[model samples]
Target: MVGMTEINVREFRDYAAGLAQQAASLILTKRAEITATDDIRSHSQTKTSAVDPVTEVDTAAEAFIVDSIHRDRPDDGIIGEEGADIPSKSGVSWVIDPIDGTVNFMYGLGEYAVSIGAMVDGQYVAGVVINVVKQTLYSAAVGHGATVTYRDGTSTILRCRQETDPQLSLIATGFGYTQTRRSGQAKILQEVLPQVRDIRRMGSAALDMCRVAEGTVDAYYEHGVKIWDVAAGIVIAREAGAQVRVPEVWEKNSARGTLVWAASAELAPAFERLLSSVGANGEID
Candidate 1:
């Protein structure tokens, strides 16, 4: 494994800040065309089974990003959602969720995105999530703060809502892979709905978390998210003054787990209590 490298946070931020912009531009330029969709679809060798849906765009984007990282920071390792997990040579690993909300993308919903996060010695250091269709970029670095930039070159600091009333908070959540998982998620929703202002199912975990980070939504909780799905958003959310946690603590296997993000620390307890009441264990595997 790569030992941690001491690098200036500003340098890291500058390197990653433009990533979402570039990705967004590329995706937008290619959208709504058969060749583009076919190119994206062809990447999936596996049939759209009930278990997983892999697309051509996912693989291509991962390859594109991995190559970019290797060229820019040759010492860093990469853990992509669709590719092999390689150990880091520089104590910093780049996590990639190349095309999140793939189902939406395949169906032309345009809600899918590219998410990238850098983890140093297993700790999230920086991340970027780009809404491909909207050309919106959300990025953050530890101690450097978080920002959202639009296609027009306008930017603003992201700040999560500090609402303390659960009954007034707008919550967001997602369904997992299996029916059993769905049932458990439903149970949690049942418990939390009456207590919160309302709930939304946006189908894109990365974008949903960004909404929370930007205060467009008050909180977000989901079961069984991969590291790539949340890694970058976690950094952005936390930097935007949101409270985040992997629902439970364990001696090992902390990298993959259920996650909760809320506007305030005080709101997390209520959400966790709801999950506990539903017999939901915050484990992802």
Candidate 2:
């Protein structure tokens, strides 16, 4: 009983990594099949808004991940972007984003990914993010650190870049689908862009966070991303020594326009001060 409740972080990390890879493979195959014979848009639909799209592959991949988790970890709960909800009796839960960049995947941009995370008592302990197009995998077990496996099959431990100067930092960011949120984000970026070295807007939130973890990007911040969009990434970034800020796991309303940011430990303080000066600390209202 106590052993089962202990929730082994390594075991959870392994589970998340395996499931993310399998789901990424499923997404790639299905995406190819969909595009080979028909217009990608025909297989997708809008959810929160006309711009907020979800594709058939997204649903299919999520179903595959949910079923796999249910079969392997029966007592664990699940919360997925495609509406998978399962209650956990084992005090462990999975947050799933089957395809983190649906629009990029639909457009063949090659920046989308599959993200999976395990949380215990509202705290993330293990996570995996598999970049479908990049053929890379990122995984982390709490207190054990994080690692990224490259397309060439080489793997390396993850770490945030060491930069104390905010003006020289390369930042990554994303925007919301709604015009109101977009308008608000534009204002935020106006203030943020001049303070950083430059800003890169990659369509995928999960990948942006992973970039911060892997030192490819000095920092990342955005508004309106949900738990599924950044759960795996939050763990990966934090384990890689990035300072992370986010709303509670249960705070699922992206419409509220909350802020999420991750920066290297060396730069986090100055970055926070910069954000405060620019008024990026609260919701986008």
Candidate 3:
């Protein structure tokens, strides 16, 4: 039998929550700094494609989180969007997305977040996602349920809507960075739009999943999302009673794979069928 660490899920969750909030605060400060200095345009750099961007804040925030993890959990591994890779010796690895929705952040659209997830032996167990501009936080620990906390200290237990009909359920989705992938996603959306109550194209996948958890949207699905993009949101959504369909390989290039989320188990099959019908399962480009 494999040895399991004597870990406290709640404690781990608390730490992740603190880390996420700290990173988000750092990002918010940096954004303010940019605005104050009128230097927003100079801080961004494109990655993979011109549409995909990484801001200086992204790197700085990630560095702050990485430094914290190194200081607090020396034995745990880290995988971050800004290229942090540390080997795990304690069987726990932390996934970090210092800023999800960089485009939104760049444009001051207010949908970005700091997402952090913890995995033990490759299985996600705890997560924290903080919407920095909105001061909203969603968190979950395995078997401990999920909750959303606001800036005023008010908190609510997350619960997904139980809409049984696909036609009446509202779904959220996002497009990938590459033009070819965007074209394929657009085609899929054309078929899915009329069937659902409506669709929301929220730029951030992490926030989209959190919206599902909070019943703001009935479901969410996407393609080509990185591990850091959905890791934290996945745990929060699942803990809120949503069903998540992750690809077999978490690290696979989702440009050729898919990630799906639904608010209710009863509505998931219908949504899956709709996606299948539109050939949304096929690789983009």
Candidate 4:
């Protein structure tokens, strides 16, 4: 029987890593099955939506992961995108987004991911984000460095972009749940477009943050992102030498929205300025 003492950070990391790998394999196989036969009956049957674009894959993946964790660490709590909310103010809590890019998944685009993060007393200690289609895993622990392992078994250390000039930096952003929410996002984009090198609207927030960690992008910011959406990615980005801050640090009541800024310290100020100029209520300046 697994006990609390046996469920250390290392053990949880290894266990989650294994499960993520297995889930990735399953996703690939399922995708291939749909592609080869052109029969999506199985896939269609499992397609359920909590919101318009969110689907059963999200719930299934979350349930599979939460169940695995509970089997070994029943005392630990879970906060998942699909399951009932479990209070996370005490002990160990795992935050999960089974499939981070639901729209991409529904459209047969292979850009979604599985995100998991473990926190102790509201502070993230370890996290992992797996790009199932790419068979890549990004992982980090509080004191340990961030690393990305590819399907070829090669692992590389990740670091955030150091580009100081906003005109030369590549930025990533995402829209919120509602059309009105997107209006605020569009306003921020319009403000930043002329200043930044380019903007990418990647569907998956987790993947967008991983891209920041991998140095493929300079930074990522989004509004209305849930705790699960950014929790794991935040750890990965910070471990990769990126500066991460919630909105509250720069303004009062900023935590009410999902605002994350990730970039090298050299460029964080400029990015923050842009965010402040366009973010809701312009509170970051």
lDDT accuracy of residue 50 in candidate 1 = 67
> Compared with the true structure, what per-residue lDDT tens digits does model 2 show for residues 1-285?
113233498888988888888888888888788888999989999998898899989999999999998999899899999999887888889999999999999889989999998888778888899999888999998888999998898999999999999899999999888888899899989998988899999899999999999999999999878999999999999999999999864565446788899999999999989999998888874
The lDDT values for all models are 0.74, 0.89, 0.86, 0.74
By TM-score, highest first, what's the ranking? 2, 3, 1, 4
Clashing pairs in 3: 224-254
The count of residue-pair clashes in candidate 3 stands at 1
lDDT of 2: 0.89
lDDT of 3: 0.86
Please, what's the RMSD in Å of model 2? 1.6
Winner by lDDT? 2
Candidate 3 per-residue lDDT over residues 1-285, each given as its tens digit: 113333666777899989888888888888898999786758899987988899899999999999999999899999998899898998888999999999999999989999999888888888999999998999998888899999999999999988878899999999888888888888888998999999899799899999988999999988778888888888899999888887767663334546455566767788888888888776665
TM-score of predicted structure 2:
0.96
Question: Stretches of candidate 3 above 4 Å error?
Answer: 1-7, 252-257
lDDT value for candidate 4? 0.74
Write down the RMSD of candidate 1 (Cα, Å).
Answer: 3.4
Model 4 sits at a Cα RMSD from the real structure of 4.7
Clash number by candidate, in order: 2, 0, 1, 1
| Candidate achieving the largest TM-score | 2
